[model samples]
Target: MGKEHVIHTDGACRNNGRDNPQGAIGVHSERGSISERLPASMERHTNNMAEHAAINRGLKSAPYDNNPVVIKTDSELCQKTFGGGWAQQWERNGGRTAGGSKPANYDFVQDTMKEVNYRRSQGQDVRFEHVRGHAGDSGNQRAHDLAQQGLGQGAPQYKYGGRY
Candidate 1:
């Protein structure tokens, strides 16, 4: 993890359908290309899920163990989800029925949280950083592009790993 291991990850869902969902991670060793498209986990747009998927996949693909991870995402919800702390205020007060809370969606967020917690327990040095996506962040932009492509058809090919 010598030259700033930057992991840029993102997920995409088209029209609330994950039929062809995708999550791409760009692992940059000092800003040079090392982009890889990770397999998707359920779809349907939720800025939080996309952001979480990216961070999870990106960190999981780091080259060195226990290395620092810098997750660049555009979703604030994604940031709060992984950065630790409380869930949405409404959810915290058992108001899953209000303020964007839907009975069908909370499950995925909960499941993702479990996975994220497991990863943390495994001694992974993870940190979530926000980047204004689509603002020309190369890795982030590439990830989003790949995700949209994945949403179309044929699972995206990994530019770095995942074939093994």
Candidate 2:
């Protein structure tokens, strides 16, 4: 196996839960960083949607080799959805929650799960870790900053770094 890679992801929403809320997602890793506002095409603009989008983007951006990838996120909802079998149960029920309704952020959840299953199918070890937000973790802080930046940007930003 190759060296493990760690990625930090975050989401932010200005005016969250109100009309005209704006959402963004941030992802940071040794390879690069991404900061982008959620596409306007999405019907809902909420913090949870942004969080799910961040995880999906992180999974899509991860390397597709045998190396392990660890994604750190502050959102317990994201952690639980991916790691606590919520996603599996939702999938088993045809993407409906136990309440017989589609889960919130269904599109993002499906996208994230698709990426995870694809990576695992190819022998990649993917994991998600829950990290306390705003606790001075540099990676998390950086990702948070990137998400904030997305809230101000004209276009999505992608910055690359030398591979580790």
Candidate 3:
């Protein structure tokens, strides 16, 4: 087992659920970093959606060959939904909540699960950890700043491995 990549991700939404709402995702790693505002088609209008998108983007940016990838995020919702058993139970229950209601952010959760499963299929050890937001951690701070800046930025760009 070699050095695993530690990716710190964050998301932000301006005026969520209001007119002209905007959301963005930020990802940071030792290889490089990405700070991109999500697209309209993604229809991400909430903070949690932005957070999930960041995770999805981070997972996609990382190569399947990179084993033991650790994703650190400030959103506990992400940790609970993906890393916790809630997502598994949801899948078992046909995407329904324990109360038999359609869960919120189903699309985001599904997309993230696909990424997680894909990494596992490639023999990668993927894990998620929750970090306190704005707690002075350098990686978390970078990601947080980028996510906030993305609220008014142009299309997002990825700089992973100096490729894209």
Point to the candidate with the largest TM-score. Answer: 2
Query: Which portions of model 1 show Cα errors greater than 4 Å?
Result: 1-3, 17-48, 64-66, 87-124, 156-164
Worst 10 residues of 3 by lDDT: 155-164
Clashes of each: 0, 0, 2
User: What would the per-residue lDDT of candidate 2 be over residues 1-164, giving only the tens digit for each residue?
Assistant: 88998999999999998888988888899989888888776776899888887888877788778999899999999999997889999999999999999999887787678778878998998899999999989999989998988888594733222221
* Model 1's TM-score against the true structure: 0.59
Sorting all predicted structures by lDDT, with the top scorer first, yields 2, 3, 1
Off by over 4 Å in 2: 157-164
Which residue runs of candidate 3 sit more than 4 Å off their true CA positions? 157-164
Greater-TM-score candidate between 1 and 3: 3
Q: CA lDDT of each candidate?
A: 0.54, 0.84, 0.81
Candidate 2: lDDT of 52? 84
Please give, for residues 80-111, the per-residue lDDT of candidate 3 as tens digits.
Answer: 88888788899999999999998787877787
TM-score of each: 0.59, 0.92, 0.89
Q: List the residue pairs that clash in candidate 3.
A: 36-156, 158-164
For residue 40, model 2's alpha carbon misses the true position, in angstroms, by: 1.6
Residue-wise lDDT of candidate 1 within 59-97, one digit each (tens)?
555554555656766666666655644444435657364
RMSD values for the candidates in order, in angstroms, are 5.8, 3.9, 3.3
Q: lDDT score, residue 63, model 1?
A: 51
